[model samples]
Target: MTLGFVMLVHTAFDRAEQVARHWAAAGCPVVIHVDGKVTRKVFRGFRDRFAGDPLIRFSRRVRVEWGTWSLVAATQVATERLLQTFPDVRHVYLASGSCMPLRPIPELCAYLDANPDTDFIESVTTDEATWTIDGLEAERFTLRFPFSWRKRRKLFDRYTEVQRKLGVRRKIPEAVRPHLGSQWWCLTRTTLQAILTAPDRAEIDAYFSKVWIPDESYFQSLVRNHARRIESRSLTLSKFDVQGKPHIFYDDHLQLLERSDCFVARKIWPQANGLYDTFLAADRPSRRVAEPNPGKIDRVFSRANGRRAVGRPGLYNQGRFPRQGFENGITAARYNVFCGFDDLFDGFGAWLARRIGGRVHGRLFHPDGARFAGAERVFNGCLSDNPTLRDYRPEQFLTNLLWSTRSERQTFQYHPGDTPEVVDFIARDPNATICVITGAWAVPLHLSDLSFADMRAEAARLQRADAAMTATLQSAGTAARLHHWTLADFVAQPRDRMRGIMHEITGPGPRRVTDLPPMRDLTGFPAFLEQLRNDGMKPVVMGDFTATPGGRNGR
Candidate 1:
């Protein structure tokens, strides 16, 4: 049986009519949930353009609020509309107006048909874990970005002005430490209906209203609880950071976006006509395949029936140490560095430890082992102050590294994934920056103490990318200027010299963080080295970090 399709959009775009036609041709139904706040002119524009397109169904307008429940509300309303309008719809996909389908329509249809039971959503649960957030620009959002005169609305104008003159952040409550996630999902009709018509619908709706990003987490959590047979992955393919936030679009990212074979690409600038047009032109006659090819990480969807355990680090990494969140303010503080990815970040943590004292924090991981060790430690120690994600995003990791360097405190990255892409990423950075090292001799546990030789060699390339990314902030004109400590010209530096590096990064005598937890965990200080200590084992230097209870046998 052919699966039904519904493409939901929150805004009006030039390509919607054309995209709708392709859906009609594929014998699928399209449901568009436009922002209720848009003007009537925009509504008529979409209606006229999509008129007579059988697959396209214009839903009642939904109001979308910024930094609030509006996104989830709009999605819920859209799902309800899609379900009510086309009850037989097999898989209702929530997408955006700017998204361009990469696979042939038939290919997408066939893939969905093959996997009917799988609810394709990146179902993540941070339940009582340390999270990390890359609000390196968290302060910026509290402020405001300058928009052109056209977007200078009287209401937002005051908001922006206040954001600039006096910083105002989104109200994050004390009791609720929420983890944000990807908003896109492709759910079965049964699952969708169950969520909309749940017996405790009011509670479900109200409970998520307080979530940081209800749109991303609500349905994801709902389905995971209700439906057992799930791929636990999202159909949408966009790179996210350690914070679990989606990657923003940049010029260098243009090629990367094209290679990402997922059905839709998003979070595009609302008015980047050239980029949007380029995306539409990637495939004209509609390339909407169901099953993604096994070629690239950009497009290839993992069919693994299971997921990395969300709250299982407690079982692996001693009793649950304090959870690190992605949102931890990366201000100038004494950040304890935790390096991960044995091959990727082994040595850099040691260098950082030398700066703040040789403290390496890590979690005992299985299968998807030391690949993201750095991220896990960062997450574990992050607590209530960060976004959390399982993926090893270089930007998020690097940004936090920059923050720690400025703070003059210790930070950690365990052995994170050692992909060439990450190496290329590091090579593109400058010496003023910090990262865990990668090499053949690096032990997974000593991810921090590996070697900086590769990073040092690639310093020039990384510096260039660092310079380029830096230019983005300036060109876009941000008030909060971000700085990086390029770790270059290593030969000239004094041996075992980070105080010099610290002074170079943050001018003037180092000021100890006036406020840090008085009671700190003992797992990090390479001196305390009591991480896995159990039996009376001979603690040598190399084995000190890995000495579980039963010496090497305990592991």
Candidate 2:
């Protein structure tokens, strides 16, 4: 599939050239539009850099301003230029000079080829309660922001407040229903053509020209109203803070960038420590192992029916404090541990196994085979017998599992025909206590290395899976005592406390607490813990352990 890129850039001309060159090397047409406000020398420099390249073109300069229609105008000019210049272009991607490709160009091409009819754009109906931007929807669509507000922010603010008090508002065209989304998107050529050639294009443009931040809503509204085939997901991944400014990716965000499924990531500061080099180097093929085969398990479980099967109660030990009723039977404890990326869970599970003098089974789930391999070595060597490591994509697997269940009750009832072997294993193991540990509600496994936007999107899916699994366990009436752990518990502890816990689990050897990779974000951990508690599951804090073979005390 032939691809075309429209980059809207205002600064960092050198970095913009690098971006153009990278895409050009990938055999894709690149069209850049420099803001009209930039110096003539800046435009000349960019022109001279790509003077010899026919595939690289520049759009007519437009004086772009933030929170205005100028940004939309610039994007339109560049997109039209790209379409006119490359008749064979199948898809048009909108990006910025600071955006970097997260995956190889060939991989992106392969994905597009596999889904040619899909328009990778994020679009949400503005009127929906979920489409929130702190009341910007009403203010933006209803008010006229015709001037450059940045030039006199205080004056414009006062004027807007006065206008609001006066009840002055613009009438939205009857045919238009405002939609909003990320300004960046990758759309099919057919969709773009329809948008540019729409009979009401002039009317639509005129109406949005006076609206605030029209770029964010213009294309989304048009596509949602007119496109035949649209996928409400952007190919570009970006993170925005509360202030609405895009997160500037630095060296620290490399792991996240490498693990993201997005084709491109935005707001990367080229001047950051090795940031440009890191991404450029990643453009090469990865050295990780191939993913595991899920088909083998699928083939085996496809013949069973959806009937509920009764199973015996599983053995469960509540650690040192085995609730009053189970004090005498603690020795017969059998545990099944499920964890995402943290090795601490595996270590704690091993400790539990030793404490109860029972068998332990560890299961490591991730989409990346390499991550699974690393987790297997850590958990199996430190805890149970060769822990099962499988290259499983949680989003895909959980989605299928949820769909296979009969929705009459909130239970984990799997249809035999559609259930995977792993689910069946958990269901049939009536004697094992189940422990599920994840970074947070959004980050189930370390393999879920996704962009911030992707993580937010996946959080809802993860919540659904969690609910479904909880219900399934409840419906089966298994004796398995369920314990849920979130990374927040680990983060809430003092550094020294975490060190002691790590020493307790890892057993004082070559591996040190500092040697482990740093945890990404722990902001969501506490809330996730509360969620588990709200769901009626007792979550054991990782920092409360006082007994360790290594003789380290946890506070």
- Write the residue-wise lDDT of candidate 2 on 1-555 in tens digits: 379899999988888888788888889999999999999987887788888898999999999889888999999999999999999999899999999876667777777787788787878886674555343776788888776677878877887788799999889987677888889899988889888998888998999998878888888888876676888878777765434666678887676666655678888987864767766663478443322122333322222111111111222223223332333332222333343333433244444344333333323333222122223343222322221323233322322322232131111212111223344345334433444433333333323566544544445445555555555555554555544444444334335444554344335666444433344443344454455446554444222222222211212
Q: What C-alpha lDDT values do all the predictions have?
A: 0.48, 0.60
Tens-digit lDDT string for candidate 1 (51-74): 776666776666776545677777
Highest TM-score: give the candidate number: 2
Give the clash count for each candidate.
107, 5
> What lDDT would candidate 2 get against the real structure?
0.60
Alpha-carbon runs more than 4 Å astray in model 1: 1-12, 128-132, 135-180, 240-255, 268-555
Residue 508 error, candidate 1, Å: 37
Total residue pair clashes for candidate 1: 107
